[model samples]
Target: MSPNLLLADESTGSKLRRNLLAVAGTLLLMTTYTVLVITQPTDLTGGLGQGVALATFAAYLLSALLLLAAVLRDLPVSTLTLIPVALGLNILLGQFVGSVMVPLYLDSIGTVLVGFLAGRRAGAATGVLGTLIWSLFAPTVLPFAAGAALIGFLAGTAARFGAVRRVYLAPIAGLVSGVLVGTISAPVAAFVFGGTSGVGTGAVVAAFRSMGDSLLSAVTKQALISDPGDKAIVFLIAAMLVYALPSRMYQSYEFVRRYRVLGNLSGERD
Candidate 1:
């Protein structure tokens, strides 16, 4: 066997250490940013500022890229290449969805794809890091990175449980993930954007406000209406994509099993 294929190779161990260090550093940087915002709320309270922003642009940009790099560091060469494609798809789709007057976010397709094909760790990394990258230009997404990470983690986990293998259960996974995201996003929307997302849902929030619903209630309602259906579709799409992948692709991924959409269950690949 090639030295590279040996799990105990010293070079591989060193690479793992380096990646772990990077993750630690990234976390520290993000924690520092959070603390600064909390301790000195006025400085970084708002994502964008013309003067004296809470944190420097360099800090935000660096943390995002570093986390992304760390997440992709351990993947096989072929699988690693897909990360960029996924990120691009997500960003473009997310932007389009944001621009349109719709409450649904179809932006998680990339995250879901990677999550199902990889595993929870990689999936969560993709979600959190992808949202961080998006935050560079769209600061609003930063607060929801946690939600993204959770959804990705869950999607990958569902695959391990054979949900994706069964077409009927895939939508259930999506709906479950969406509800989880809504729980996290509600507070973020309420406090960060004050229940307005500049979309069709925003209008619903406005109506709720006029009807004397609390900001939290309005945002939560909007999420209830929009997130489940949108996330169900995202999961369904991801399942379909997984079904289309060749068997070789599954071999490259540690968490993904031999998946055949229509084949009888022969159990997971070793």
Candidate 2:
């Protein structure tokens, strides 16, 4: 075998190892999070049992599988990374912070990020699959999944037209996608899981009423007081930091290529 072929094999092996390690780390993080969330001490905490927990595990497994498939198929790493991060963070936030404002917002951000990076077809596929997995825990997430797929398709198309690559444009895309997905999800969640009764027909009307009341209350409360907790603020900062790192690394990689940095550093004789 030629030296070039040997180098290619070595690089491929390294990447495979990195990808496998990333997946393993993600699984460990998610599993730890799920156990903590489902075994919380309060009755009102809505802890899922073994069956649901297993399902949640399966969801992450599916997400990993999807990401691995994307890698094998030569999709961009930006697109694939979103799945593991989203799954891990969603569980973490839900466990530590509860499924209140932050978790929902983060979920929106994740979906939008995936949609932005992957383009419409892949984005839609990932969004639908990811959302379906999430639905195992919260069935009301279905509409959000559907809406995300639509938004992703639009965003992907816009990206092709150069409307999504700009930094200024990204937040706009994210906001629009968030609003569309969130609106549909909010109603469905309210309708499906808002009531005190069991998850069925008799609870539907009460669920809707309660959800309307909560929405009104949230608006009023937000207008009156803004009390963001330290934990939430910290988590937000951390998330931003984490998201920015990948882009920065990608830029560094580009710079290295442009300057032939890696080529020159290697001391191999011709």
Residue ranges of candidate 2 with Cα displaced over 4 Å: 1-82, 93-104, 154-166, 182-243, 246-270
lDDT of 1 at 137: 86
Candidate 2 per-residue C-alpha lDDT over 1-270 given as tens digits, one digit per residue, 9 for 90 to 100: 668545333367667865775466346435643453445322222543344444444544454444434343444455566556645554565455544544223343344334444555555555566667787987655434544454445445544444433344444544444444433333222222332222333244444446664532232232112112222232233334424654445233322223321233311234
lDDT at position 158, candidate 2: 44
Q: List the candidate 1 regions with Cα displacement exceeding 4 Å.
A: 1-79, 93-103, 258-270
Model 2 clashing residue pairs (backbone): none
Best of the candidates, TM-score: 1
Q: Please report how far candidate 2 places residue 73 from its true position, in Å.
A: 8.4
Clashing pairs in 1: 43-54, 44-54
Candidate 2 residue 179 C-alpha distance from true site, Å = 4.4
